[model samples]
Every structure is written in structure tokens, then in C-alpha cells.
Target: MSYRWLKWLILWIPTVVIGLWEYVRHAFLLPYVSMELGNWLAPVFVFLITLTLVRRLFAKLEAMQDSLKRQQVVKAAFEEREQLARELHDGISQSLFMLSVKLNKLDRAQSEADATKAMEGVRHTVRHVYEDVRQSISNLQNALQPADSTWLQSIHRLSSELEQAQGIAVTVDSKLYDGLLTNRQKVELLAILREALMNVQKHAGASAVTIQAEHHGALNVPVPAFSCVIEDDGKGATEEELQELGKYGIRMMRERAKAMGWKLNIGPSALGGIRIEITGGGASG
Candidate 1:
């Protein structure tokens, strides 16, 4: 019950009992002793008790209201951070992409000696700035929203971009089960694949590139997992190149696999190039 109702009931109970007692004593037993001072003090005592109870209740209510306001402020701050991240990714990121493309085009134009040297310096600066902006946008976007690309889709898009932009022939084959990979895993795999493919295009000088994906079951084995293998037939790596790959593409692939709790294998391809294999699934996957 409310404090107000409880307080009133407590004050009324004694008054009712005393009034009945006085009536019975006067009518059947003896005349009741009455005091004007006691009558005046009864209301004073009740008033003091009621005031004390009300003051405590109000203090508790004000504390609860303050707590709620603090929580609301925290919620608002979190929402603002998310909104700022989104704006940076969607707006500033696109502008940087456009700027990078224009700088690349300017760098490609044949020019006089002095002009070429000046453009080279500009290009170098622009490239560094582009890298920084891209990384910042990627970090912010990752924090604000879940990745939208699937493992298969990320690979497909990267392949298409490389082919269109760099004249590399790329193909994909897969029987991917949709929604079978987490967003973080998908993005990491895509980054590894892009690095591997870029190495092939820039150094391998291969005329054609092929990508294939198939389900590999590890039933009755020590570790049960699904496997994905990517192979390319191109200029094979030298021993020195193989060693350096650990500092380059192989390291990226390993980190991505580790993050997803996967086992990764990198070796020479049967067709005389490189082969990368990864196996695992995240909890959501």
C-alpha cells in the first residue's frame, strides 16, 4: 500500500480504540478521565509522524529520478558516437575514394621532365593519405555496424574489381551455403584473398587466374572441420620469395585463420604456383 494510506491507518487505529473504551467506561463502569492537553497533543504527534514519513519518501523518489536521468544521458552519448562513425564511413570514405582515383589518373599521364617529377611527389603523398583515410574509415565502420558482405560475396566483388581495374583475369567457383559465416570472419577472409590475388597479379604475371571452393569433410579425423582451398597456376615462387611471403600474404592469411579459430595451410600449388587452404567455422557460423 502507499505510504500515505498506511500512515493514515496507523493514526486512526488508536483513536478508534480509545474512543470506544471511553464510551464503555462512562456508560457501564465509571466516569472517564478526560484531558484537554492530551487531546491537543494527539494531533501534534500524528502531524510530526506524517511529516517525517513524507520527507523520507520524497527523498527516495528524487534519488530514483536522478538515476534514471543519468542512464538516459549515457544512452544518448553512445548513440551519438555510433552516428558519428556512420557519417565518417559513408561520407568521408567515398570522398577519399574519388580523390584517390583522380590522383591515380594524374599520375598515369605522360608529361615533361619537371612536371613528371612534381606529379610523382604528389602521387606519393596522395597514396599515403589514401591509405590512412581508408584504414580510418574501415575501423569506424567496423565499430558502428555489422559487416554486410558474406564470405562468397566479398571474394566475388574483390575478384571483379581486380579484373576491371588491373586487367587481371579472375574466376570463382563455389557452392557456398548462405549465412554460414560470421561477418568478421568473412571480412578477414576477403582481405587475405585480396592480398594473395594482388601478389599474383603484380608479381606472378599469370595470364589467367582460377578460384575454386568445395566442401571437404573431415569425418573420423582428429579434427572435424570444413575446408576451403584456393589455388592459382602462375609463375612459381623462388625459395627467397617463399620465405618473404611469411612477411606478406602468408602472415595475413594466418592471422585471419587464427582469429576465426581455423587451421590454415600454405604451400606450392600442384600447378606450379601457390595454394592456400583454410578450415573452420565461428560460433555463429
Candidate 2:
């Protein structure tokens, strides 16, 4: 059954049936059944219905969690494929272009020694390209493996990729404030982090990046708040540039924050790089 249908069946059916029974008792069976008996039976019926509903809800939730895990695996595979595509386009394609120019030089060489040296240069370029392909493949293989942690797993992987592939230093500091986040919150927050990191990797040219997260709340609030900050040491963007077309995924980030009713700020960090800070409502998402 659909969740809504099952919920109505489990929670309301008993109450409705019992209410009808009570009405019938007063109308026609008043002498046959005691008021005390109906009183005791109402609680009993409600308790039984609630128990059944709780069990069914938990089972459905478990199944949904398993399905989400499978989806995550598929997403990882697609992400790795994208990574391979970028590596091929950026690294191997450029190398091949350079190699072709060298090949032209080899064809027009002056003498045997020059030809030999040209051949050696070609071999060197070919070997480097081969190693680059091998590394990309290995990275893809490793990235497709299952994760055994929370949503922070992807964040850690992103940081590691930046450090290893781009030679940038990254540090991630995340904590569950009063508690963990819902699946919706995790997904949105992960997207925000990825976009922020991508902007740094593509444009910041910062030597170091730091990601910090926390969940906290005020004294009167019943739910904990969610917040994160991404800071880098790269060149920061100007206010004028931020309004221009297609600048550092700024529009996408702003839209995401708006959809979630989050307060987002983008500006220069103390280290002269861009800083992105996000704060959202208590029990966000």
C-alpha cells in the first residue's frame, strides 16, 4: 500500500470503527454494554492501532533507506565517469596535441641525431600521457567503491581529490550539532559544499581550502540550527564581478540557499580568498 493509505488504514480505521461502535451502543445497545467497558476498550483499540502503525512505519523507512543507498552507489559511478571524461579532455587531449606538433618536427628533422632526439621527446610525452590515463582509471576504480560513513563521506572525497589532483591543501571540520540531519538536508548541504569547492578548484587558485560545519541553536529554540563555512586562500571575487554573468557558480549557490530559506554570504576571507558562509533555520530541511 502507499504510505498515506497505509497510515490512514493503521491510524484512523480503528478510531472510526470504534466511534461507530460507541454510537451504536448509545443508540441501540445501551442496556447490553457498560459505559466502563467502552471506555476501557477505546484506549485498548487506539493502543493496538498505534503499535501496528509504528511497526509498519519503521519497516517502510528501512526499505527506503536501502533504496537510497543503492541510488548513492549509482551516483558515485556516474561521478567517476565524469571525472574520467574531464581528465581525458584536459590532460590527455592536450598532450596529444603537443605530441602531434613534435611529430611534425620529427618528420622535418635535419639529421639522424635530431630525428633520434625528436623520437625520444615523442616517447617521453607518450609515457607521461600513459601514466596520466592509468592514474585516472585507478582513481575511477577507487571512487566507485561503497561508502561506509554519513554524507560527510562525499565531502571528504571531494577534499581529497582537490588536494591530490590539484595540489591544493584542504581541511574539513564537520560536526553534528545537537543531532544529525535529515536526508533532504544532507543532500542539499552536500550540493552546496560541492559547488563551493568546485568554484575554488576552478577559479580561486587558492593553495589552501577549509570547510567548517556546525549545528547549534539559541536558548529559546527547540531545534538545532545548521551552518557551514567554506574559506580559501585564493584570490577573492569583487562585488562587481559577482553580479556579472556566470561567475563562480554564484547564481546556483544563491538559488539553493533561497530554496532552503538559508542565509548565505559570499565575500573575501581573512586570507584574501573567497569565503562562503551558510546558515539556515533550526531543524533545517
Candidate 3:
């Protein structure tokens, strides 16, 4: 039966049984049965209906709920896969296209200095593409990694990677509870953090980077919001570079923040380099 029909049947069965019993007791049994005996039998009727029909109906409803939950899990997995595909297309694919363009420039260079500049551009594009792919792979691995691996651990891993690969010092100071973020939020936030650090390694010329996250509102209550900051001590960007910051990877970070209903701000850090701030509503999901 349809769900609505099941509900209607469950609701009416008790009433119908009680009404029929009452009618029979008054119309026919009054002559043969005592009032006390009819009153005692009423509870038996209710107990039998609840034990048999109502219990079965409840079981079916529970089964349907479980099936729906399973379907939702499958749907969420598909959605995550789709998101990964989009990230690859927007990031790595674009970098590859840029790499091809740089190659064309290198091929057409007419002078030694021109060829050298073009070669540098080609190298930069190749390095950017490599970082993009490596970051994507690391993110996927983190997703499939054991649940014992916490989000903070992922952050530290990313920091460690940067420090080892680029010889830059990375420090993390996080106060926001992990329970405050959903898994999807944590993933997006991590990607954003990774992109920010890559930008530092590529262009910031910094020696040290700091990542800080702070929770807002009371500890035991619902947090209204939180903020995470990635800052570095390096040569800051010029106005022209700041204006072009939204071109590639930084644009992806902005899109990720927008998807999460968050704000991303880029500015000069007090420590001498750039600062990236991501602010969003606190989470319980």
C-alpha cells in the first residue's frame, strides 16, 4: 500500500474495531452479557489490535525510513564526486591550457632574452599545474582516509607538506572545535587553505606562514560564526598583482567560499605578506 494508505488504515483500525465492539455489546450482548464483563473485554480488543496490526504497520514505516536514509547516502556520495570533477575541470584543466599557451610562446621566441623569459613562464605554469594536481590528489586521499584522521590533522599535514617541499616554516593555531564544522565544510576549507599556501610558496617569497582559526560565541552554546586566517611574512604583493589575484586559483577559492555561504578577504598582512581570511557561519552538520 502507499504510505498515505498505510497511515489511514493504521489510524482507522482501532476506531472501527472499538466502535463495532461497542455496538455489538449494546445491541445484542446486553441481554446475555453483564456490563462488567463487556467493560473488561474492551482492553483485550485494544491490546490485540496494537500487538498485531499497529506493530506491523510501525515496522513497515521504519523499513521505509531506513531505505530512504540509504538512498540519501548514495546521493550525497554522487554529489561529492561531481564536485571533485568540477574542481578538476576548473583548476587543473585551466592550468594545462595555460601551460600550452606558455609552450607556444616559448616556441616563438626570437631572441635569447625573449626565449629565457618565455622559458621561465613555461616553468611557472608547469609548477602551478603540478601543485594543482598534487593538491587534488591529497584532498581525495584525505577524504578516503580513516575517520581517525581529524580535520586538524589534515591541516597540519598540509602545513608539513609546504614546509618540507618549500623550506618555509608553517605554524598552526586553531581554537575552533572540529565538531563545529560539517565534513563538506571541512573539505572546502582545507582546499582553500591549500590554495592559499600554494600562493605563498609561488609568489609571496615568504619565510614563515601562520594559519589561525578562531571560534566566535560561547563555548558550550551554538556558535554564530568563525574565521580562519592564512598569513605570511614575506614581500607583499604590488597593486597590479593584487588586481589580478582573482584570475585562477584564487578565483576557485572564492567560488568555494561562496558555495559555503562564506566570505573570503585578501589583504596585506601585518607580518609583511598577504593574508587570506575566510569567514562563515558556525556549523553543526
Among residues 3 or more apart in sequence or in different chains, the pairs in candidate 2 whose N, CA or C atoms overlap within 3 Å are: none
Model 1: residue 87 alpha-carbon error in angstroms: 25
Residue-level lDDT of model 3, residues 21-76, one tens digit each, is: 99999999999889999998988998899899998998887888789889977965
- Count clashing residue pairs per candidate: 0, 0, 0
RMSD of each: 15.8, 6.7, 6.0
In Å, residue 187's CA in model 3 sits off its true spot by 4.0
Q: Per-residue lDDT tens digits of candidate 1, residues 1-285?
A: 554665666567556655765565457645343456445555665556557764565666666668878986696467446544543443345556756766676667677765576567666556645544554454345444445746566667667755754576777887554455445555555656665675564456565677776544533443334566667677777667865643444555676578668777777788677777776653312
C-alpha local distance difference test of each model: 0.59, 0.72, 0.81
Best by TM-score: 3
Candidate 1 wrongly placed segments (more than 4 Å): 1-146, 218-224, 281-285
Worst lDDT run of 10 residues, candidate 1, spans 215-224
Comparison by lDDT, 2 against 3, better one? 3
Given candidate 2, what's the lDDT at residue 180?
A: 57
Ranking by TM-score: 3, 2, 1
For residues 89-148, write the lDDT of model 2, one tens digit per residue.
655787799799889989999999999999999997797577567556655564444433
Candidate 3, run of 10 with poorest lDDT: 242-251
Backbone-clash count (model 2): 0
